[model samples]
Target chain A: MSPGGEALSRILYVEDDHDVRKVATFALKAVGGFVVEPCESGQQALEKAAGFAPQLLLLDVMMPGMDGPTTLERLRALPAIAGVPAIFMTAKVQPQEVSRYRALGTLDVISKPFDPMTLSATVRAIWAGRDD
Target chain B: MTELMGAEAEMRDALRRLRADGVQRLGERVRELSAGWAALQPRRPWDDADRARLGELAASAHRLAGAGGTFGFPALSKAAAPLELLLLGLRDTPAPGGDRLRQAGAQVAAVAAAWEAGPAGAEEDGADPGQASPAEHGEPIFLFAEAEEQAMLSAVIANLGYSVRRASEREVLEGALPEGPLSAAVIDDAVPDPLAVCARLAGRCPLILLAEDSSFENRLAAARAGVEALVAKPLEVNELADWLDHFAGGRAETRYTIVIVDDDRLLAAAYAMALRQAGMQVTSVSDPAQAIEVIAATAPDLILMDLQMPGIDGIELARVIRQTRRHLSLPILFLSAEQDTERQILARRLGGDDFIPKPVDLDRLVTLVRLRAERARALRAVMESDSLTGLLNHARFKERLGLELERARRHGTTLSLVIFDLDHFKSVNDTHGHLVGDRVIRGLARSLQKRLRRTDVIGRYGGEEFAALMIGTGPEEARGIIDHLRERFAAASFETEGGSFGVTFSAGIAGNAPGGAGPEGGAEAEAMISAADAALYAAKRAGRNRVMVAPA
Candidate 1:
């Protein structure tokens, strides 16, 4: 996927809810036309992170086991996941929460109750400005 | 393209099915919340197990809030938010209470009520990924305070007709996206390192420092923190509301009316379109013969007249308009190819406010019209205030009613017109001198100013009748406010040279919201005034000194 490096092609997505993961898969794969690895828990993400290298990280902030930030921390230990741009999606969009996520090395926080229709485009937008 | 369409269609189909599932899930959550509220012990000490159970309930509410919000049921989501917050607060503390707990039940009931209200604007946006969200959930006002203060402050802001999103206690935000596009932020002065925190938050939103004393040092520090406004700690709601309104920006601009009097139909149409697009109500007079009639009917803020015409020139027409005392100060800009310096000078000397060359740029024309009309409206506002009450005089009051009604129609907001006639004022003058009656009127005016917001328009409609225009206020709310005013007025005793005398005035309120059906028969200000007048008549018939709402 990185051979044509100019275009973003893969995303590592971790969310706790099955329904949300399904919707996200459709949005990121079918609509966005990008390869996606949708993990139901941060533990699953840790297990798969090294094998399925991704250009971006899309993680749900609140999860059943090992929430988004902790998951991202663990993922950074994997050699394949180094310096990958990450985004947090959560209903906790208070300014402090956004800042906390940013300080944790995420690109930005996508407010939960996010329009799934715009999810793909939002992902691409974050990836487009990665260098900035 | 075919493949793309196929995939898109499948996506839409999937979204439709998911939305249905989301609705069912939401219904389940509402039931779960109701059950959770029912399970709560009002007076019992909350144990760890109880707290955990309540935490699950809060989680349910949080899920419902997020799902409802995303599934196009914002009202339900908004109603669920407070419940979730309340539960969070309760779960954190051991103190058990009945009232706030009951209030949590009430919040659940509201969520159920909103869910019963059903989904609005759901189907259309199914396939339209880029469809803008309905402004039903306008950018909420962020209450950046401790959890203790947040609930109280959130209630206050919500009562002002704005939705509220609050920060958890001990929240520290250094960079962007606090509550997602905050209309304004209220900073608790007790927050440690408050000044530095505010400085970090400066450009994110308009920061309002809620402080005990606006001492010079604090004020200086506040300025450095880029606080746009301040509210004294003793939190006067009216002052807080006023500051919030000031910072909310987009305070519904003055929609100035313009009269375009041109002989050439095409040029007149062009000017009218330009001005109308720029939000000025434009009246085009292609036949300059009826210019006065149109201008009088429109009562325009400014006139754009053509300098050259076959029968009468722009200067000639303006000369005629200036002859009328009422139209004397009305700004008139003349459009003419007759660019002779002498003609321009002549036009300026005789009632012409400005000279526009024949081919005027539409953008420049719009800017000029806006600037001129704004000045005219300001001047007119001064000229329009009643000498006796410092409210708008009858004619100007009527004009503003029309303007405000137009605005209400445009913005889909609410407007209420109140007509107050002092009961048996002739008798008051007979009993006490006319000076006493005048004092009575002045007294009522002061009472109105005291009770109503500064944004509300008050006018001396007649010698003894007063009118008030309330913007963005619904009928029931208007009635409540005015009824309170009516009580205050009746209670007030005006002390004169001889003795103090009490007076009472009857008030009738008529209000309209876009798509709202009521006694405001026609959306026109004339109809509203008459409706209010009829209600006032009914009040007088029933017996005086009562506030009556116009009936549907």
Candidate 2:
């Protein structure tokens, strides 16, 4: 959902694990009340990105075909959604890796084993405070 | 709060449903994959087809390992990890005997069986479903206190989000020490011969002493016992919490990179494994000739080099590294079996920061390496940082810019630079005096530091002007970020003696994206700086408080 007037509505989530995708999608839809289009792989994400017109890209770092950073690079090359903000979901998010992901222009990183109940709230907080 | 509870309930219900669905799907997949694996089982000598089959098994195992954990089947995940590793190894070598293949196949079948049998079977196999062990979480703090004090201290530490173990007796403490690596140890004064106990546990974990004695003798004894901190009782929970916070924040999980160089492979491996167990990223080099290459690639925080090697000695290697301008201040530690005092002195003279003898006590070695590396890092920060703003100084900034440009060229990535000058900074100084002007400058520095990503290196280029190196950012994105920073800075008010006033800045951005003109050397860095400077001037000419991107 759009936090204030920024219209951070459409979120394209790319995760490999079907179970995680299912639970997280339920959280975003029922708890977060946002329109979420979940993709199983980075390639599928790239194929659907322009058509979905998501305001934000929630990507998984380690995917099978075209990992999150490479996918972000390709997405940035496309004229549509070139400047959209992106966030990464990763399991092994060390301090150095977090900085590296940020260098790739991600707005933030959400570590894995995330709380399903609070996941939507966390996303909303990041979106609301992005201007800072 | 009620809405949040409702949402939580909803999420929990959804997760329960998903877990059920996932378990069923996992059982089906495991059965199919295990059947495929059993059919491919080698009866006699392994061949290419068997190797290919092993690859398939490994890939499926990898997927299972990842999915099992996510789907609330941690037992399956745990069983699959070693199997995956085993299969991958077999795929690589394929020469493992029939026994090895049999063991791998049995392990795969066990995992499949575990999945099929569901929760009851996993519990029967002694696998905890959702709970992770303490070691899997993080290193725990060990507290040695009197029986009366133990409960209070442990409760306080546990409340502070630390996994703590309490022991009142020496035997119990000694047994607990081997359970896992400790983050830190705290001892109460009531413990008999506390100094001796502290000395015994000193290098193993950072030790803190809580003593009632404030005498100089006791303080001196505690210092000699290698205690990092001594708190005079009665210890406040808040004070102990503060100390624990510092210890946890500075734990080795920060992943300080270390490079160990020794011609002796076994010795090097031992040192590497010990350091790695302590949470340092360690790379070992057996050949001194490859020392420079490894150092360049890893950018290690410390170098542990053996003094005596066959061809190039540690002294020569250290000298070679010192010859490189970038690594001049990097700490080089000498580890040697030689007992010659003269050689140790020579090694220190030739750029060795510290000397440790061979057959190093593992605990002492880890402590010394951590201390020296942290000290070197602090010294470097002081030397390279600006005094007023704490950003990189001009000279250090330029040096890093050159290095980052070289890296970007080699990696075929983009590097962008943003230069921002405070608009009418002279007028601010003229109106509010230099003291307030300094405050305004510091204010902008703080904002930049807070707003920019950690990977973006911000530096005070000169008086009232700041620059940032945005690695992997393009011209347009850099402009957007800088423009946002500019707008925020314009809106921020600064307090002065007279009243409050707002400050704004103009910025210029230049990026070298991939497939564009590649930056070669220091000259390219200089060109980028000049281009950004030219664009900054344009922004100033077009009325300040705006951002401009340098034309490609």
- Candidate 1 at residue A41, lDDT? 94
lDDT tens readout by residue for model 1, B374-431? 8987887788888776677888777777767766775778888899999999998998
Candidate 2 stretches with Cα past 4 Å from truth are A1-132, B1-255, B264-266, B273-280, B430-436, B495-499, B513-520
- Report the Cα lDDT for candidate 2: 0.76
DockQ of predictions, in order shown: 0.09, 0.09
* TM-score of each model, paired residue for residue: 0.44, 0.46
lDDT, candidate 2, residue B493? Answer: 77
Sliding window of 10 residues with minimal summed lDDT for model 1 chain B = B128-137
lDDT digits (tens) for residues B1-552 of candidate 2: 999898778767877798678667778768877887777754446688777777777766665665575565655665665566667766775366443455466567667765865654433322232222223345678888877888888886786667776774664445334333467888887877788888878877788889999589999999999999888876644456557757764443356799999876555655664475456788889988888999998988899988888888889999999999879889998887678889888888989988886555444678899998888888887999998887999999999898888788877889899999998899999999998888787778867876788888999999998999998988899898888888877986766547778889998888864663654667788889988999999999999899999997
Error of 2 at B50 (Å): 35
Q: Which pairs, if any, clash in model 1?
A: A95-B178
